[model samples]
Target: MSTPVGGDETQAPQSRFAGITAALRYPDIRTLFISTFANQFGQGTSHVIIGWLVLDMTGSALLVGAAFAVRSAPNLIVGLAAGPITDRYDRRILMKIAVIGLMLTALTLSGLVYFDVITISILLCGVFFLGAFQAMYMTARQAYVYDIVGANRAISGLALIGLAQRISQLIGALLAGTTILHIGGSGPFLAMAIGYLIGLTCIFMLVEVGDSAPDRQETIVENLINYFKALRSNRLLLSLMISTAGAEILGFSHAVILPILALQVLDVGPEGLGLLTASRFVGATVGIAGLAIAGDVKRPGALLLTTMFFFGISQIVLGYAQTFWVAVTLVAIVNIMATMSDVLHQSLLQLSVSNEQRGRAMGSWIIGIGTAPIGQSEVGLLAGATDSKTALLINGASLAILALIMAALLPKLRKL
Candidate 1:
């Protein structure tokens, strides 16, 4: 039987996967892993494909940034609702709907491309809707992992799922590049749609995990009120949310300028851009694999801050990389720290809350990262005004400083 978060873990099934941890033994977790792989593949594919499309169309870094910013705009809208919605419904079905949304958007894009009627405005609108579904899927899947694995193995469950996500990102990015070259015409969007379709089927295969805990979540309005109240009371949660936002705003925003780097800096084409993108995911996969091998962590919060600091440091170095392979290596290093920061923040936040609040907490996490639009636009603008290298240098320094400041100011966060 699937164990709900906050359930008595000892009473759940004792079955274990022979080569893996207790978390993978649960069939639901395994199914979740498979679905997450497909889901993230579509996600990773869409981002690169769109960025390339924008660059190809306008040859403007600023416009590319705007398109990506539009893609992230849905996070702010859907993030708040995702919490209560996830808490209120069957997570599997919610995820299923989200995957279908992804498919529909991909199909729409393919059709638009095929007709040669794809404009910046039309593309931005489709990207916005596509991001909406991706945000929901991201939020629900984390809560789903916590529910099935419980607190004891939350790290393992999430890390394993992260592995799937990272691996798929690597493949998706590489394939997106190849497809853009080989298939040419509506191939990228069609590939994204197919990935989402496969992912949706995997979601249906998940054993239904219902949250029937005695203290069911209250109404949406009540949950919002409670969220604010909890934010006030839980300093660590507040710190986490802010820090998560800071990471996205400063560190992750560098992704917005990647097209510039590929064309102007790295002197590469779309296929080469794919290699650059995959380099980061390769780093993420390796970092997560290390974490998974380490098993349960004793100080995820402290480690998270450390990763954030290094994340900044790596970006600073990345700004100076002139050679293509050198650039790839630095990008990978940056994401190794980036993915570690992500996994730690997520696991720490999930462990901090009771099962009743888990979904909302994940939603809050989504909202935190939803701050990406501000960064995407900022970095893009900065690249437009200055060079890509200068923008990365400035943003990287700010992120490192932010990490150190948080470490000093938030004692409770470090202790966690």
Candidate 2:
């Protein structure tokens, strides 16, 4: 007997290869992806090298923290303007200029090391410039992805981009340690500069496929006012902004206490601390990969909320983890949840706004992430007063509680 007409689905299932393949079909996207990978790889390498270099120079934890802070501090100042600037200009040009700026900064820093003239003040100046360029690149890149693929394929496209960055980060981190061991501090800096150059080349080949937002005649202050005004009108976007900021401050911020917990509480020592740190990055890779495999989720907002809730739960358990292995597993779980949330959150945010407003929306989102330094300080103070474990436990519980409240209040976000 003949099978039913539509039921003759004997071909291989499509879900088996549900990762980056769809997005990779576009030549421009492939070029863009490569560029993003190179930049992220460079960032990963530079991160480790900068921290090590700072420690070697000053031999003080405070200075090391300050050095890293210099790299991140620009996000707060630049984030608000990033979206508006991205919306009003050609993303390709923005990225090119930004990448070029990054390359120059990296090379200058590398030259300092080469000439043995690297000073803390000079290093801070270089990092500040690096961070400023990164802010623009990030805002423009996200808007550009939507422009290229449109909303239909955006989730997979962005997921693919994230996967590339995550993998590159792992490679860069691994190479950083070994490169430093053999060739001294200059090795990683030069390597990172090369990566930036590679990224610049990729951007050079990337053809702009999306419409550029018409230039607004408004002044900077007026544009800033418009951005906030737009944000206020969309309750869903506003809710997402608040919820995301909350996650960063309450859940993500707890990471600041990890070093302390590893040393004082778990007694894991430096080796175990490395493992513990590495586990989270590894987990981030797995988490993003899982999202890529799933491709499009029917209910991204719900998935986002679930991740946030579970992340908080993971943190609570992590707070109580007594053994090194237990802490590692818990930290991985937390990262898995956090990464999933970020992927979903970003995809959903992109889908929620218009192309003209996309950059501004992203800028608002970046503010949430930019709150990291604030959260770090907050968690540090809390930990200082009442043990790291207690601080983590409180933050975790607070995240879960706050997420639930937001979900209940923001029906629009729940339905997304």
lDDT of 1 by residue, 199-282 (tens): 888888987573332158677788778877888998887788889899999998888877888977787999888888888799
Q: Which regions of candidate 2 fall more than 4 Å away from where they truly are?
A: 1-13, 50-69, 111-125, 211-225, 258-275, 321-326, 383-387
Collision pairs in model 1? none
Q: What TM-score would each prediction reach against the true structure?
A: 0.94, 0.85
Which 10 residues in a row give candidate 2 its minimum summed lDDT? Answer: 1-10
Q: What TM-score should be assigned to candidate 1?
A: 0.94
Evaluate model 2: give its lDDT: 0.73
Worst ten in a row by lDDT for model 1: 11-20
